[model samples]
Target: MISTTDIIISICYIAFIVALGFWAGLSGKKDGAAAGEYFLAGKSLKWPMIGMALFATNISCLHLVSLAQSGFDTGLLAGNFEWMAAFTLILLALFFIPFYIRSGVATLPDFLERRYNRACRDWLAVVSVVSAVVIHIAFSFLAGGIVLETLFGINMFTSIIAIALVTGAYTIVGGLRAVVVTEAVQTIVLLTGAVIITVLSWWKVGGWQPVMQVLQDGGQLDKLSMLHSSGDPSGLPWYAVFLGYPVIGIWYWCADQTIVQRVLGAKDENHARTGALFCGFIKVLPVFIFILPGLLAYVLYKQGHLDLEVLRQADGQLHTKGIYSVMITKLVPPGLVGVLVAALLSGLMSQISGALNSIATLVSYDLYKRNRPEATDQQLVKTGRIAAVLALLLSIGLLPLLNRYESLFNGINDVISHIAPPITCVFLLGVFWKKASSQAAQYTLWIGSALGAGVYLLGKLYPINIPPLMVAFYLFVVCVVLQVMLSFAFPMQHTAESNRLYWESPLAPLRVKGWPGLANYKVLSTVLLLMMAVLYWVFR
Candidate 1:
């Protein structure tokens, strides 16, 4: 049962997000009904809105609940998912963003079609829409439902419906403008709520020093170590963490059309770059919010003062805490409990709004517009809004099925890691390698994705298990190797016309002008270096 105080806080939060949506709706209408104005916010987002929008869409309930579970299981080392992402962002800044902006494309699939062929575009669009609607949002909804049920003693099904209805109503009415504006507010609430929880956790656990001391006493301080002396027999291997993490991040930040679209839809490349950089910076904060709480949980367990019970063996090997419930019922107070609930909901809200808007854009622009080139802007917008409503219902329907996964964040990551690498491979090959042909691109994508899906399934089903991340890399390698062989065997049928066609398009690769002066490169590099050093120092 949600306390009345938390319920009140949640209501206030809903009102705030809806109000922002209304504000965006008002502003967006003043600009009239052009596709650019309604769907892309007139391509006028400043740095702050751009930054927060990107952050909001990227960070979801997975961060709040799934990431917390990872911390409980692996200590600080579990943060490889969040921290290793910086390298991918750097790659985007250096390579992908400039070319993407040059393309002047509204969506990633639009680039695919122009770069390769209609087949590539249509195939990728199918995959992208399915993944966004069925996999990403559904899995996230499931995870959010789990957190809601555990935290508030509410029915998971009810929570799922309620969240979907609220998110869908706003997104359907307001389009991208509402999504962006609401995302900004959601990001602020999420950050503030997390800080409050972290501060309170530290205070209750006798501050930073005593928290460490308790962890030491429990003989579980090794949880904080990034490097495992030996790979876990059951859990993700450390080598996979090192390589797989970066690969997954590359797909998400640079190649995942949903994420890159935010940058692409920016007013210009500079705004895109700045927004991405700000998101990269904000990405560093997960350790403080999610990971620290897991460490605090360990401290509470060791001291025998924890509000949640820790199951244990006769030999005293640590077992799982009811992580979802413990994080809420144990760590938070009454009024603040509502605050954290809102934080969890904020994650859910950002992801849903983003998917609703993006899926609609793809359906309207990439699919419907391509087929019916003569359709009016109003027709396209109406179709997009209808698609959003349909997608929302489908996602809400899947929330109940999400309970089957062991770890919510890990499950979603595992699924995305498989599907994403193949797409990323094609995009990278298409842009940088001028010789890449539609035929070669199509073959590589099919062969690579088939191999990836097969390997991932085998890893899951077989007793001699392999990590999903490793399977993704193995598939990536196979695809690249195959693309090279095929390229040699069937050289691209590049003609003067095709070359001209590519060059005329906005997304065509720019001739490398004298370095774009990555303003934050050194700062990001230093931060990554310090993080590595600190981890090694503590573990050593």
Candidate 2:
């Protein structure tokens, strides 16, 4: 049970977050209350805020709960999800951000229209909005609801409503500025709380050696290994990690609106790339702060300090869900419990608000303004606010349905793997392949969506048993082949404007001198790459 002190602390944390959000929103109003200020923070976000907001948005309640559960169930392999993001984030900073900024598009769909056609833009906007509501927002609500239900004994429905109201309150009022400002604060709270849990859990397990010794004694040493065999059913296989994970990572890190929107709101190219690099560095923390704590939880359970009965099935096997909650309830002290709960709630709110803001941007700019091109700045901002509220309502309505899934992490990954391949194809080809006609882009989207739906439905109806990761890889290959064929058959005439949008366009001289050495982007990119390599080496 939560003590009086813990309850007070948690309530205070929530109130402070809401108040901060409102303050940020009101500050944004001072800047003109225009669509640019509201939707993209007037393109004035610096590297620090951009980095923190990106990290906070990505590390949602799903990462806290589901990723921890993954560590508990499948071991160190879960760390790959956090660490491998380094590569994709670097790609975003070095390659994608320049083009996006040069194109001067507000949303990713807007970029598609500038590169291809309005038809391509419209299709992508529709898909993006739907995915944001159904997958991103809904999953956030579900994860937050699960945490509240397990810890505070709050019912899922009530938890979802409470979280939605708190998150949407700030997002609908303040827009991107409020989301970024609040996320920057939440990032600090999340890291501090996670660090506390990690340190305390490690101390409880009598340190690293003892934890390793317990796993070794239990004949579970493979749990410490980062790479697993293809035949290893308990952990992620190497094949999936190599061929499939990047597909999902590209869509998430480079192409997704919720993430890219942060970079889009950057003050300039240097800030955008710098912020992405900073976020990449921050990404390394999850393996230690989040996953390791879960491993520590498993160790504590083995040491008989934690009750495993509630986390066990009738077959005497461990069930991974609710492991994080169990760890907190059994191990953390009262006031500190409030801190960790605040951290978890921070993750939840960050993701929901980011999604809400991105959805508003997508609908208001990409869809509504397309029909009403002469709409005033105030009118566009109003449309975005209305769209945000509607999206929140739809997301809350979908929360109960999320209970049907056994594992929140797996459900999220499966949905992304199923739907992401086509979108990834479109973005990759649209940016790189000059010959990729608008017609080819359209065909690829339609065909890829149809193929993905068929594969997902067929897998569900029958016992296909293929890993969703591998399925994602296969789908990507097919889309690539189709795009190449269609583009060659019906190529579009390229112009100077279209050529400028590509990577090698005349946005030169590309090199900018940094403080006493090489270019800033190159320096940061090299550091991020080296860090990623060292992490994989150490963990592997």
Candidate 3:
């Protein structure tokens, strides 16, 4: 059950978030403003805000709970999800940022139309909108409900509604500026809380040496091993770690709007690149803060220092059974519990607001006005706010359904893994492959979606015992390969037409200005390669 202190702290945090929305929402009354100001914060974000926004948006309740659970169950293998993210983030800063900014678009879908055609743009927009509704927003509500139940002693349905209403309140009012600014504050809270919990866990365990002893006794000492262990069930096989994780990470950091919007909001290209690199550097620390608690929880369990039986009820099941962060509450004192709960809420609010805002941007610019160019800016903004509210309702309704999944993290991972391949494929082709046509783009989207969904359903139905990660990895590879084959087999005579229709405007693409140092691509690639080598050496 949640203590009174935790509820007080949570309520205060919500109030602070509402205040931020008030500050940002005041700007909504400005007349004759460009969409840039509303959707992208007038492209005026600085490096610091960018970093926090990225961190806050990316580290949601999933990390607080599911990641901790993973560490508790599987030990160190979960760290790969964090440390490997650094490389992909750097890759995004280098290879993708320039193109995204140079396109001068309000949303990723707008870029798709500029690169492919209206059909391609519409296809991506539809997929993205649906995914936001069903997967991203819905899962976040589910995660928030879990947080509430664990910390507030409330039913999941009531908690879901409460969380959604709170988050959506600020999001609808404040828009992008509200999301980013609040994210900045929340990021600090999240980091401080996580670090505090880790430190306390160490001290309570009688320092590192005793902690190690406890972990070793519990058969969890090797949890820090980065490489797959032959004896381990959850470990990613060696091949999958290198190829699979990278692609998935790239798909997330580079193409996913929730992340890219942070970079896109940067005041300039340099800030965008700098902000991304900074976040990339910070990505390496999750192992210590998020995953280690699980190992520590296992240790506490082994020593009988913590009572799991008491932690459960008549069912012989733990409260918040699959939530990893809940372990910390049982181990920590009241004041510290308030801080960590605030941090968890911080992460949750950031993701919720970001998704709500991004979906609005897409709806307003890509779908709402695409066929109705006569709509005024005020009208579009009104529609955008409505979309935000509707998105929250969808999330609120889906939260309970999500709680039935085996692992909250696994449920989120499955959706992203399945959706990413096709989206990544078409976006990559649209940008770099001069020969890629609207027809080819459409075909690839269908083929990739089918291939990815088919593999997922097959693995589930057949009980193949293969990792879902493996299935998703192979599915994407096949789609990309077959897309290439099919494109060549039915190559059309639209080279000049494709170039005319799809090529980014020369001035727009070349708008980037700076005394170029090491190309971001070279710097990012080199750094990631070195980091991978070091990680492999350690893991090996």
- The alpha-carbon RMSD values of the candidates against the true structure, listed in the order shown, are 3.8, 2.0, 3.4
lDDT of 2 at 136: 78
* Model 3 misplacement above 4 A: 28-30, 229-231, 310-325, 490-536
Q: Write the per-residue lDDT of candidate 2 for residues 1-540, one digit (tens) a residue.
A: 577788788889989988999899778665455788888898999999999999999999888998888878767778887888888888788778988877777899888878877888898888888888877789888888778888888898898898888889988888899999999999999999999989988889998898889899998887887778877885368788878888889989888888899999999988898899899999999988988888888888888888968767899977677888888888898889999999999999999999999999998899999999999888888888888899989988887776677788888888888888988898888776677887888889889988988988887778566777889999999999998899899888776677666655433324545334543878878888887887777766
Q: What ranges in model 2 sit over 4 Å off? A: 30-33, 312-318, 505-519
Q: Which of 2 and 3 is ahead in lDDT?
A: 2
What residue pairs clash in candidate 3, if any at all? Answer: 76-223
**lDDT of each residue in 377-426, candidate 3, tens digit only:** 77787888999888888767666666767677777777777778777776
**Candidates sorted by TM-score, best first:** 2, 3, 1
TM-score pick, better of 1 and 2: 2
Q: Native-vs-model 2 lDDT?
A: 0.85
Off by over 4 Å in 1: 30-33, 310-324, 494-540
Native-to-model Cα distance after best TM-score fit, residue 459 in candidate 3, in Å: 3.4
| Candidate closest to the true structure, highest TM-score | 2
TM-score of every prediction relative to native: 0.90, 0.96, 0.91
Q: Global lDDT of each model?
A: 0.73, 0.85, 0.73
